[model samples]
Target: MYSLATGFRIPVLQYGLSPTESLLTKINGGALAAAIAAAALSPPPAAWPFGVVGAGAALLNAAPGPRSIARWGAVGYRRLREHTAPASMTAARGETVTWELYPDHGTMQNPAKRASFHAAVDQALRFVSDQARTAGIQVHVTHHAITGDYTTHTQTVSVHIPKGLVASPARVLETLEDEFAGLGALMRVEPEPIPTVTEQGSGWVALDDDRYASTARITGWPPRDDGTLIRKFLLGDERPPRDAARDVVPERSMAVLYRPLTQRRSRWLTRIQEAANGAFTTDPIEKEKIAIESDGRHDAMVAGEVLVDVDAYITVWGHNPDSVSAARWTMTRLADRHRIRLDWLAGQQHRAHVMTSAHAVSTRKGSVL
Candidate 1:
């Protein structure tokens, strides 16, 4: 986790393994345990083969490259099985309310205007979060940006209230709609259902038809600086001269999910974290860094700013795999330039693809990948 001056932590997103990998890990552990038991019950020679087999499997699974290969293989096998029976298609569950935010075209082109618009959006989200907390519920706010030509973008913010969490979901939507409209941006509610993903591959998924997309999760952030990290990341360098032979501008979408912590909870957690750091830290340089971070958190809390857990996903789209892969490479290069790290959803691209939409609820709780 990285601390930002804006009182947000980068990469608060939890890491989880795919089901196949997870099952393999458990089996490996059990095999190792059985090997130990066999050795204890018998002599060395009798258990030598068991131990060797268990150790070899464990090592193969533990290594990064091999593990990734195994995961990809597992997904490929599953895809083949699915292809035999096309009716067993999977779909995301639950309903979501999405509000599209259309800011003036100049808001994205002008740096100052973009910054100001972002601040307003943040304030509006914070207000809605506070209200949701009072109502004893958690609301997922997902900001989505979709562009076809890389010139025109459609941005939307979606709110998802978990079922049975509140008495009246419609009332919550009303409050959110009102607060977001105050930003002076054109807002509209989308009535269409979430798009169904038709096909899945190693690193990409086909949405509905003709649209192939690859999704990646932001894993690491650049060093602390002014809170313009996201701005610089989204508004990359100017487009290069277009060449038909080299340029493939694939349709793309970026989604940022925000889940805010209540003021009381944020303060309590920060205090505990500070105490743990101060008590355990020994290196002088690292201790100084922690102290500075603690102070920044303190100041931000005092200023009445809410601390939020944020996770972001980007999806690059095309009509074919090759073009999508090309666009994904471009995105990877841009991320590297900003000192950001991305984990392309190798085996779970379908799920990550759904996450790039406003209708999909944020993964606040653990779910199968």
Candidate 2:
């Protein structure tokens, strides 16, 4: 299951629990306790812990050394430097350029695997933008990819700069490393092995509410107990979202496909719950919650589909800005009622170009939000 990127050996493993048949045999032989003893004796599985597949992918993306992290950072700096080199005229105008960096990693590297990596970087970039906007920072990201001598897979890194946030590459890397390190630890992950984050696919562009095309990675949910749950995360044709091109979006854009929601959607739901005076937390609320999560088809969501919990930034494009008024009203009214300060997305004004912020999730589809 290994692949090549920079001529290094990448230990390839898919998402979800590793094979248990060997352990199962021990259990059947009435030696399960001994096996557990052996594992406990072997060492806890790495420094990171994730639920099933998430944990596996996280582990695969672990950093091997500081040199690796620096490589990715270098890649990000290159793009940022190129995209937003301070113009000599910018100085006299009393303008400041700021740059922000966000780092992401996945263990299972794919040499031939193009789509998933691009999607991974996209998801990570949006997550960073969503956080920064909420914190009142203007940011643009440049990607990076890093490699080891014998590894066949590429390690990805993306740096977001606030258009001249720092005066020098060294300073930028220093500041970004500190911030992303904290995020990685908070997420129970290794610090990004900063490298050139190269995107290998055509990339994604949200066409409209009903359809999102040119997207690299997409998450889907199919209520199946089979292994298809993990396959979608690691491998697939990268299908278009159902109802993406139609009048109605069949799937909820705000909901992270394979990942669960803890902040963005979950936070919104919490506010609604609180504003409703714990209505969502109580008996009636539980039912309401169930209704939203289960908002999908009744039949199988395509065979061999994988379902994992993810948190992402959902964008809707090419919609009539005027029509978003209803959605804006709904959100604002909810905010007022709950006393929650909801912010609009940047690069958007008068419903024309809304971006995200630190406290709220950024979504292109307001109706879904």
Candidate 3:
């Protein structure tokens, strides 16, 4: 587990080993232990070869190496067979409300306007957190931005409320629509149909013939500061000189999913973390850092701020594989400059692509890879 500067601890990767990988790891460990025991009980020249083999296997299976090979091979074989007949995905249930926000001109440029806009967003998210806590259900709020032709851009917010979670999901959506309108922005509710993914590749998925998209999750974010890090990452440097032609912008869609934790759960976790901080660390500097984070968390909790878990994924689209690869490279370079880390969805491209849509939140229990 890694703790962010915000004092939230999230797993490095929300996934664990597949069954095949676990089986192989167990077999290798057993063989190594048996060989070592035999050599200790009776020293023999013949036992040395078995020990060597076992040791080699163990070494190969060490951190981030051959241990994942079995899983990779299995996924690769399955994908190979899928090439003959591409796999498709459709929504299991629920509807989504997607609305575009058209803010006043220069809203982001003026500091006062930007602050007001941000405050409205924060209030809206807090309402969502409250609803999730009261209903005991997960609510997904996805902020999606798209640059289709690289000349014009659209920013839309999608809210998904699973069926049976509340008395009326439509009422919840209507409330959100009113919230955005209070931001002094034009809110155009766009009803989107359930998207159907037609084909999937190793790292890319096809929504149709013209759009081949590759999705990557943001794994690491720069330290918390005045929010400049995200601004620079999502929106590039200020506009180019009037005389200079603008750089080529790749067609892409970025979606960020925010899920707020319940008040009770957040408080419980914060208390546990506060107790565990200095108890486990001895270094003075490390202790100080943890102390600061603990104080921050406590202050926020006292101030009626809700803690949220955030997941961001970007999908770059193109007409062909080569074009998609090029856009992906550009996206990687941009993330690197901002000190953000991205994990491109390799074997689970189809699932990752579905997450980018405005469909229902995944109810599947277990690790979310």
* Top-TM-score structure, candidate number: 3
Model 2 scores worst on lDDT over the 10 consecutive residues at 1-10
Collision pairs in model 3: none
- Residue 175 Cα positional deviation in candidate 2, in Å, after optimal superposition: 4.1
- What digit string (tens of lDDT, one per residue) describes model 3 on residues 106-199? 6666778878887887777677767654423333444444454454556667676656666777777788789888665645565465445577
TM-score of each: 0.69, 0.23, 0.70
lDDT of candidate 3 at residue 50, scale 0 to 100:
77
> What's model 1's TM-score?
0.69
Error of 2 at 285 (Å): 7.1
lDDT of 1 by residue, 153-259 (tens): 56677776656655677887787777667555646666354456677666787777578888887767776645566655555444556733243344667776666
At residue 143, what lDDT does model 3 achieve?
44
lDDT of 2 by residue, 1-369 (tens): 001111112222112211232233233334434445655777763322223334333333343531123233433454344321122211222112222333234322333333443445344433433432232122222222211232221112223333443345345445444554443232222232112212211122222233221111112233332333322222222456772222222121121212222234334433443354333245776766655643431121222122222322322222233333333444344334333333232212212111111111121112111
lDDT values for all models: 0.60, 0.29, 0.59
* lDDT at residue 93 of model 2 (Cα atoms): 20
| Candidate 1, pairs of clashing residues | none
The order of the candidates by lDDT, greatest first, is: 1, 3, 2
